[model samples]
Target: MTTTAEPPRSPDPGPVERETVPRPSQDEDPADTFEQRKGTRWLEPRLLLQTAKQVAISGVLGQYNDKRELMGGISPGGYLDLGGAGTRDDDGNLWLDYVSDLGDSFEATYSVAALLSRPTLDLAPQEGEATTTRRGRLLVMGGDECYPAASVDEYENRLIGPYRAALPGKEPDAPFLQAVPGNHDWYDGLTAFMRTFCQRRWIGGWRTRQARSYFATRLSDRWWLWGIDIQFDTYLDEAQLAYFTEIARELQPGDAILLCTAKPSWVAATDEDCEAYATLDFLERTVIRPRGAGVRLALTGDRHHYSRYEAADLAQRITAGGGGAYLSATHHLPTSIQVPPPTSRARSKSPSVRYTQGAVYPTPEDSRRLRWGILRLPFTTPAFAGLLGGIYAVLAVALGAALREPARGLPADLRAVDAALRDAGWARLAGGLADSILALLLGLVVVGGAIAFTQDMGRWRGRTVGLLHGLAHLALAVSVIRLAVTLTAEVLAVPAPWSLALVVLLVFVGGGILAAELVAWYLLLADRARLNVNELFAGQAIPDRRNFLRLRLEPDETLTVFPVGLPRVPRGWERRPDWRAGERERFQPADGQLHPFLIEPPIRIPRTPPATGAATSRTDEAHRMDEAQRMDEAHRMDEALPGGMA
Candidate 1:
C-alpha cells in the first residue's frame, strides 16, 4: 500500500509561557493593510429598482420592523452561572463556532460546515488520518442565529434542522456554544433565542452553555474573547457595564482581547466621526481601553457581507455576517471610510486593514420571484398620482363646460351627470370650489418644488440629478396650463374657473411624482458613496465572499486566526478516505432533500508585518492548488446531486 507524506506539527509550548505572544508593532502602518480596489458603482438600474423597494418597506415596517420596544428591553445577568470559562482540551489549541447569520438556508449552512471540517489550523490542512469527520471544541455564533422574527418554527426549520443536517451527529459535538442576540432574534421578545442558545437545551448536536447574552471566554491563560450584547440601542445597559467592569480587573498584562460585537460599528459609521457606531466607542472608553486591555481584533456580522478595517491602534474590525442571508451592496456604504491605499501610513505606521466584497444585487430572477417594485412606494407613487390626476382633471373640465353656457353647454350623454350633481346640490358649489382648488394646487407645486431644490443644494451630484427632474416637472406644469386655457376654451368652451382647476390638479400631481423620483434616485447615489467609502478610496471593487474567523491561542500564547470562507474546501476532502458507497449514504438526509454543496474562492491572508515588495506572494503554492481544485469538485458535486435537490 502507498502512503502520502504528512506535514509536521508545531511543538506545543506550555500554557504559562507569556513571551511567545508578540505585541503589535508600533511601526506597522495602518494604510498598508489590504490591496486597494476600485469602488463599485451604485447607479445600476436593477439596484435602483431594488433600493426603492427597500425604502418603501422601511417606511411601513420601520428599520427594526416595529419591534423596537421588544428589542430594546434588556436581559440582565452575568456569566457566572455557566462557569464563565471556555473549553480546555489537551490539543494545545481551541476550535470555535465562528459564524453569523447562521440560519435560514440549508444549502449554505452545510457548505460552511464542510469548509471548516477541512482545516485543523489557520493554514494547515487536516489530513484524514484518524477520522473522516472533524469537529470544533467550542462554538461561538457571531449573531442573528435565527431569522424572520425568531419564532419557534423559524428556529426549528431555519436554525436547528439545517445545522443538524449539516453537521450530521447525534451526540454532543462541542462543549459549549455561545451567542449574542441579533435584531431579528429580538423581534419576538427573545423568547426563542433564549431557549435555544442561552439555556441548557440541546440544539442539534450542540449544547448551550451561556447564562446570558454576553460572555467572556478564556482561550488560554493570556488570551481571552469577550462578546458584548448591544441590545437594540447603541448603548450598553447598567448590568452589562457592571459585569464587564468586574471582569476586566482579572485580565493579565499583555493579554490579547478579541472583542465580538453584534454590529460592525466601525464600518457602519455614517461620517468621519463615526456617529452610528457610537457603542464601540463607548465600549473602548469604558471597558477595553481604560483597563489597558490589548484589543487585537473585533468581529461582527449584521450587514450580511464581509469587510475588514484596521485602526491606528492595531485593532482590526471584521464583518462576517454572510452565513445565509440576502447580501448587502458595498457601494451603498457612506463616504467617510477610506481603505486599501497600497501603502502604509506615513505618520502612524500602525497596521490597518481596508477591504470589502461585491454583493449579490437584485436581478431579473429576483424581480420575477418577488414583485417588490410594483408593491412598494416611489414606484407605485407615480401610477397612483396619475390615476388621481386623470379623475380630477375630467371632473373639473366637465363642470366648467356645464356652467359656461348652463343651457346648451352639456353634451346629451353628460346631461344626466349634470342633473345628478344638481339634484345632489353640488352644482351650486362647483364654480367657487373649482377656483379655490386651482389656486391651492398651484401654490403647492411652487412651494414643494422650492423646498426639494434647496435640500439638494449642498450635495452637488444630488443637485445635478434633481435639475433634470425639475425640468420634467416644469414641462408638465406648462402642459397643464395650456391644456386648460387653449384646449378647453377653443374646443369644449369650458368656463375659465373650472378649466384652470383641472390644469392645477394635473400639474400638482405630475410635478410631485417627478420630485419623488428625484429624491429616491438621489438618496441611492448618496448612500452608495457614503457607506462604501472604504472600497472607493482603495480604487477597486471588493470581491463577493462570505467568511467567518477562528482564533486559537497557541501553546506559546501567540494567537493565530484562521479566517475561513464558505465552500472553499477541496472537493474530495469531505468524503471519508475509508468510506465505501454504502457508508456515504449514512451522511445523506433521510428525506432526500440534499443540495449540491457549493464551493468558495480561497482568501489570501498577508503575512504579519507585510512585505512591501513581495506582497500577495506569501500564500503557499501548494495551498493555492488545493483551493483551485474546489471548482472542479463543485461541478462533480453538482452532477452527483439528484435533480430535485438543487
Candidate 2:
C-alpha cells in the first residue's frame, strides 16, 4: 500500500468543540470559571424588517404633504379597507368579521392631509348599536406623533408610515386629521409635530399666527373637532384659551365635539400624575361640562392603546392612539392605574370602585415607574433632603463631639515624618498619603446619610429628585465595605480623590458602565429573552441539569446525576436541564414511569455487538433499528414537557 500524507492532530481538543465531554482550561481556575450568558431585544426582527420594507415600497410615491398644502389641497389614492374589523366576541372568541356586509365604509385609519380635509363618519349607528358608519372623509387624530428623540424624520417613520399602512379609508390625505403632541413628540421641542401637521398657523393649516399649535376644526356642520398638544404646555395661552372658552360657549348643546389630546385623561393616573401635560382638564371644564353645550365623546391617544372609559358623569373617553405608535401591552391593571368614580352628568365627584373578581388592580404605590431615577428632579433643584443633608454636614463639623466619640485621627495608628523639598522647603509627610482628606470625604458621606434618617423618604416627587441625590451618598460615607477599600488605596499612597472618590465613583460609574454594557449586550444577545424578567436575569447563568436536579461532578471526578435518580445531588448543586440548545431528549427506560420526560439526554451505555455467531447480521441490524426507534420515541415524549417540569 502506498503511504498517505495526513495532518497532525492535537492529543486533546478545546472544551466547546468536544462532544460527550465538558472540561475547563488546564491553566484557568475551574473553581471561578463559568459560561457567560447573553440576551437580545426584538423578536421577529427579520419579519418586521420585511413588513417595513413593504411599507417603504408602498409609501415611496407619497409626496411630502406640507402643512400648508394639506389643509385642503393634497390629492388622495391610498389602500383603503373599511372591512377589516376585529374584536373579541361575547364568548371571548376573537371576531375578525370584515365590514363587507356594510357598504364601503372606512371606519378608522386617517392621514394628516386626509384628516384635514374630511367630515363625518357613517352616521353613528342607531342608538345602542356599535355599528360604525365611517365616511371615507374625516379628520385623523395624531397623539404624540413621533418617536425616539422625536424629530421630523422620526415622525415620518413612526407616525406617517404606520398611519398609511393602517388606514381603513379609501383616500389618502382626505380624512380631516387632528393631532396632539405626545411626550415623545415634544422630545425635541415638538418641532416634528408642529412643522408637519399644525402648519395652517391659526389652527391646523389655517393662517392664524397664534403663539401655540392648538386649534379647533369643524369636521361637519353638526360636529366640532378640538386637538391639544400635550407636549406644548404654552398652548394654553391667553388667546387660544379665550378662543376655546368662547368656542365652548358657541358649541351647540347637541353638537359632538371631538376632543383630542396627546394623553387620554381617563387612565388611572391622578390629575397630579397627569400634570405632565397640565391641560387634560380642558375637555371636562370647557367642552363637555358646559351646560347646553352639545358635548359628544372625547377621543385622545398617548399610551399606545385603545382604552375606553366612562368618566364620572361624562361619556366615554376613548384613547385610540394605536394608528402607528408602539403597541402598549394590555394596560397594567386598575391598581397600577385607577379610574375615579364617574361624575354624574349632573353631579361633580364620584367614589372609587374596588377591584372585582376578574378585574386588574395594580397598586399605584407598587407600580409607579420603578426605573432608576424614573421620578427625577433637576440636578440644580434644591430639595428638602439636600436642605437636611447640608444642615447635617454643618452639624457633623460643629457637633462632632456629640455624634460619635470614635477615634478622630484614628488611623492605622499614625507615624509622621518630615521631608525636604528643594523647591518648596521642608514638608511634614503624614503616616499615610493624606488620611485627613479621606476622613473628610468619609465625614461628608456620614452627614449625608444622617439627613435621610431625619427626613421621611416615602414622600418624594419631581422637584425633590435632586435633593435625595445628596442623601444617596450616605452609602459611601462610613461604609465598612468602602472604608476597607478606600483606606487600602490611601495606605498604598494612591493620590487624593483617587484614594476616596475613585472607589465611590467606581461603584456608581462602574454600575453605569455595566448597565450600558448590559443594555448593549441585551441589544445583541437575547432573541427570546427581551421580557423584563429575562433582562433581570441577564448574564446570570445558562442554567442546566447540573443546577436544578443537583447534578454535580463528585470530588472523585465522576458525573453524579442527582435528579431523584441513581444518585442524590448535594443541597445547592441541583440538577435540572434548562433546554438551552432546544435539544431533543430521551427518557431513561427505568425512570419513564416516574418522570415520563427528560430535559436532557440519558447517559449512554457503551455496548458491544453480539458475537458474530450469536446473532445473524440481518437480525442484529433489525434489533439496532428497533432500539434506535424506541430512543427516538422517548426523545419525542421528553420534548413534550415544559421547563418548570418537576
Candidate 3:
C-alpha cells in the first residue's frame, strides 16, 4: 500500500465551537420543533408559482451574471486542502461518502442525516460478502443542498437544522465537508449556497473548507476528487477552468480522478444535443487528458435516484441523487448510451464511448408502480386542486353570464343567469359556449398552458397529448356546472342566495378535484410514453428509497463502491437519551425502522495503469483480455447472490 504524509493545517485556528443543535430559543418548548415533518410538496400551488418565478429570473441572470467570476476576487484560486482530515485507515485504505439532492422535508432529510452522522456502519453483507465500513473522513455534498428555492430560511430549516441536530457537537477528528452547486443553488445567484457553505461554517460536526463553489482536493497519493460547478447546465466559467488547470499542473502521469458535477450531463447528452456535455468534454480533453491523468469515475445527483453506467475503457458514470429529495423514475433510463453524443459539438473523430447501464435503485419495475401514487395528488396537494377549482369557477361564471339576456339591473341579471344555467341542457351549453367570447378565451388559456406543460416528448406528440388533457378538463368543468345548477335550483328548490352559494361551492370542490385528477392521469400516461416522467414523480413528492454512496479506496489501488439505500425513511423521531452524555446524537428514529440495505452487490473498479505522456492505443488482444477479466469477476459475484444482478 502507498502512504503519503498528512498535509499541514492552517496556522490560524478556525471559528469557536458552539452548540450547533437547532432548538427553539431558551423561552420556547422543545416539543414544538417537529410539527412540520414532511418533505416539500412540489405540487403545492404557492411553491410551484414561486419556483417558476425563480427559475425564470435565474435563467436570465445566469446569462449576464457569472457568479464564478465574482468569486474569483474573493478566493483568487478556487482550491481547498482537505487531505489533513486523514483519509487513510490503519490498513492504508481511504473512505469517503458522496450525497446530494438533500434537504427537503424534515422527516426524510433528518432520517438520512442521522445515519450519516453515525461513527461507523456495520452493514451485514448479502449471501457472500466480508467486511463492515466505517464513516468517511471526507464528506462531499454533490449539489442542491435545499429544494424549492435557495434561501437562508430554506437552508436553515431544511438543511442546516436537521444536520446540526444530527451531529450537534464538534469532535476532535471531525469529517471535512465540501460541496458543488446545482441549479436550485443558483436560483439566488448562489448567494445562499455561498453563505452556507463557502464561509467555512460548520454544518453540524462537519467542517467546511472550500472558499469557492467549485473545488479540487487530493484524497490519497494516487487519487483526487474534483467537484465542478456548471451553473444551470451552462458552460464552465473561465475562472473555474483556470483553477482546475493550475491544479492539473501538479498532477503526475498516473493519478486517478473522481469527477463530481451538479447534473449528470452524460445522461442528458444521450437524449439531446446540449452544451452541458460539451463543456465537460472540453474540460477533460483540454485540461486533465493533457496531464496524463484519467477520470476513473463521474458522479452526479440531479435525478434523485441511483444508477450506474460503465463503458469498456472509459470512466464509470453514476447518478446517485437519492439524498433527500422526491424520488425520480428509473424505468425510462436507456439501456445504453454514447458519451460525447453524435450531436455534440465537442465530438471528435474518435468514436463515442458506449456505456452499458448497470444497477439502478428502486428497480425499474418498482419505479413504474410508484408513478401510480400521483393519483392521490388531489388529496396530497389540496392547494393545487384549489387553484384548478378557482379557474373552473371563473370559466363557468363567465359562460353563465354570456348565456343570459341583455344586461339588466344587478339583481335581475343574476336571476336571469341563474335561470339560464338551471334550465340549460348539454346541447344548449355547447351552443352557448360558441358565442361566449370571454369563456372561449379562458378555455384557450387552459389549453395553451397544458400544451406548454408537456415536455421531453417531441413538439407534435406533446401538443397532441396536452390538447387532449385540456379538452378533458374543459368538458368536466361544463358537466360539473350543469349538475351543480340542477341540484341547487331544481332538485333542492333552494332560494336564490343559497342556490348561488351551493353552485359556487360545488364548482370549486367538485370541479377542482376532477380537474386535478385529470392532470394526474395525464402525467401517468405521459410517463408511460416516457414524456414528462419527472413531473409525474415530482408531483408525488415521494420521501422514500433515499440513498447515498460509500466508497473505499483499497490498498491495491482498486476502488469499491457501496451504494447504500434506505427503502423507507422513518417519519417519527425522539430525543436520544444519551445526547447530554456526548456519546450520541440529539435524536434517533422513534420507530427503529431505519434499516439501510445495499442497492446491489458492491461495484469494484479495478486499477488501471497511468496514461503515458503521449496518447496510446490498446491492441484488440489487450482489450479482449481486460473485458474477460471484468466478466469473470462479475460472474463470480452473480453466482454468490440468491438472484443474479440485472
Candidate 4:
C-alpha cells in the first residue's frame, strides 16, 4: 500500500473524555460555594455510555429517505440543490453563525432536542461504499463567507478551515459544489469571495459590472439564477432591473430561476425605506409571477435557519442555510404570501426555530422529516453536573474510607492524626467532625452540578466561549494557589510527604479542571470533534439511522477519496484478508418484524474514526434491521441495511 501522510487537520478545538474508566478533572470554583466544589452522587459510567452510544446511532448518520428516488430538476421539472452552512474564509478562519445560536438559546431546551439528534451524528461507510453517498451537488447561500474585515485571513480561517474539515473525506466522492456571496462574503469589496471561490466568474464580465447592481448566473445551458446585492433597504437597481427584464425575455416555460440576497427582511431595517415594500413587490411580481413561466424556487441563507415556503398564490421558497455557524430561533410562520406591515415591534429576534432531533433535514416525503440545528455550548449545564457529581462521589467515598483507616496511605507527619485518633477519644470526635464536613461538601458539589445542568443560556462563539473559560480557569487557579500556600506553610513548619502530596494534588486537580473547561470552549465554540468527546463527536455529527453495508477498517490500509463527482471505494478492498464472507453475522427479520446485526464483514470500511483517526467506528457495530417479512414489503435499500450501523 502506498503511504502518504494525511495533511494535518485543524488543532484540537478543546479536550474530550478519553477513558473507559472515570477520570474527571477536579474543579476549583470559588464563589464556588461549598457545594460547587464538593460533589457526591454519581451516575454509573456504563449508563452514561449506553445513553451516549444510543444517541450516537442516529446522530452521526442522518435518517434515511428514498423520496424522489430521483434527482431534483433545474427546469420546472427538477434538479437537486444543496448548500454549505457558511464559509471558512480565504485565510482558513472558522467563523460561526452566532446570530442563530443566540436566538435558539432564548427558546430553551437544548438537550431535550439533543436526545433526538445524538444518533444522527455517528454514521460511517457501507461495505460496498467509499464516500458519503447520499449527498448530492452543493450550492452556497450568502452571509458568513468570512467575518469582520472579510479579509483573506478571515476567509481562510472561517471558510477554508471549516470546509476542509467538513468536505475533506466526502468532496471527492460527492457531487460538485459552487457558491454565491452573502454580506459577510462581500466585505472586502467582494475581492475575498471572488478570489477564493470563482477566480473566473461563472458570469462573464461579472467583475466589470458588479457595481451596477444585480448579478446573474447561468447554472446549466438552460437554467439561470440571479440575486440582488444591495444596501440594507434598496430595490434592484436600474441595471439589475434592466438585466431582469432581459432575464424575463430570455425565460422559457420551464427554466429554473433562483433568487438570492442577504437580508430576508424579517422586519424591515427601516420605516423610511420604500424599497422594503418595493423589494417584496419585486419578489412577488418579478420572481413569483414568472413561476408560471417556469421559476423553480427562491433559495436564500441570510435567514440562518432552514425553511420551506409555498404560498397558494406565490411561488415556492426553500432555505437550507443551516450548515453550522451558530443557529437562530424561528418566529411564527408568515400569515400571508405578502406580509402585512407589522403594527408592533417584532418580539422574536430570529426565525429558524424548530429543528429535527433524530431525523435529517430535507426529509423524505413519506417518512416525515424533523428539523434540528445545534446551538453553541450545548452541554454546559448537564455536563457540569454529571461530571462533578461522578468525580466528587468517587472522591468522597475514597476519602471517607480513608478516614476509617487513616494510616493506610498516610505519610510521616500526617500520620500523627492516625496515632492521636487511636490514642484519645477526643481525637476520634474531631475526626468525626472532619468526616461530616467532607460529606457535606460532597453533597453540595453533586447538587450544584445538577442545578448547573439546566442553566440553559448563551449564544457564544470561540472567542466568547474562550473568555468565560479563561475566567473559570482563573477562578480555579486562585483557589488552588490559596490552598497550596496554606499547605506549603505546613510543609515549612513541619515537613511531611503527605503534605507535599496534598499540595501537588490540589494544584494538579485544579489545573486539570481548568484545562478541561477551557477546552470545552473550543469543542463547543470551534466545533472540534475531540475536545469534548461527546459535544463535538456526538452533537456535531447527525446520527446515521439508515444505511446498509457498514464497513470497519484500521489504519495502514489502502484508501483514497477519488476526485470524481460520484465518489466510490475501490473494489479490491471489499473483503478482509483474515475474515471470510461467512463470518458476516446474519439474522433475517421474520415477516415484517425488525432484524438487527453487527457486520464484522470481510472488508474494512475506509476512513478513520474521530477519536483515534483510525478508519471506521472506534467501537464495535450494533444494528437493528427489519426484513422481507417486515411491514409493507417496501424496499428502502432495505435488503441489507448497515445504514449508519457503525
List, in order, the clash count of every candidate structure. 22, 53, 1, 105
Model 4 root mean square deviation, Cα atoms: 23.6
Q: Quick one: ranking by lDDT, best first?
A: 3, 1, 4, 2
What does candidate 2's lDDT look like per residue over 83-176, in tens digits? Answer: 1111112222211100000000111111122222223112111132222222222234445444333555555444343233233223322223
Ten residues in a row with the worst lDDT in model 4?
Answer: 98-107
TM-score between model 2 and native: 0.36
Q: Per-prediction TM-score, please?
A: 0.51, 0.36, 0.88, 0.33
User: Which ranges of candidate 1 are over 4 A from the true structure?
Assistant: 1-91, 113-135, 172-175, 270-273, 311-313, 331-544, 567-646
Q: Which of candidates 3 and 4 is the stronger one according to lDDT?
A: 3
List ranges where model 3 is wrong by over 4 Å. 1-37, 76-85, 125-130, 347-350, 456-458, 581-583, 609-646
Please list the C-alpha lDDT of all candidates, in the order they appear.
Answer: 0.46, 0.31, 0.77, 0.32
Query: Residue 331 deviation, candidate 2, in Å?
Result: 7.6
The C-alpha stretches of model 4 lying farther than 4 A from their native spots are 1-138, 161-178, 201-214, 218-223, 231-233, 253-256, 266-277, 283-296, 331-337, 340-646
lDDT per residue as tens, model 4, 491-606 = 45424444444544554555445434444443444432112222332332232121121111112321111111101111111112343221211111122221112112122212
RMSD values for the candidates in order, in angstroms, are 17.5, 29.6, 8.6, 23.6
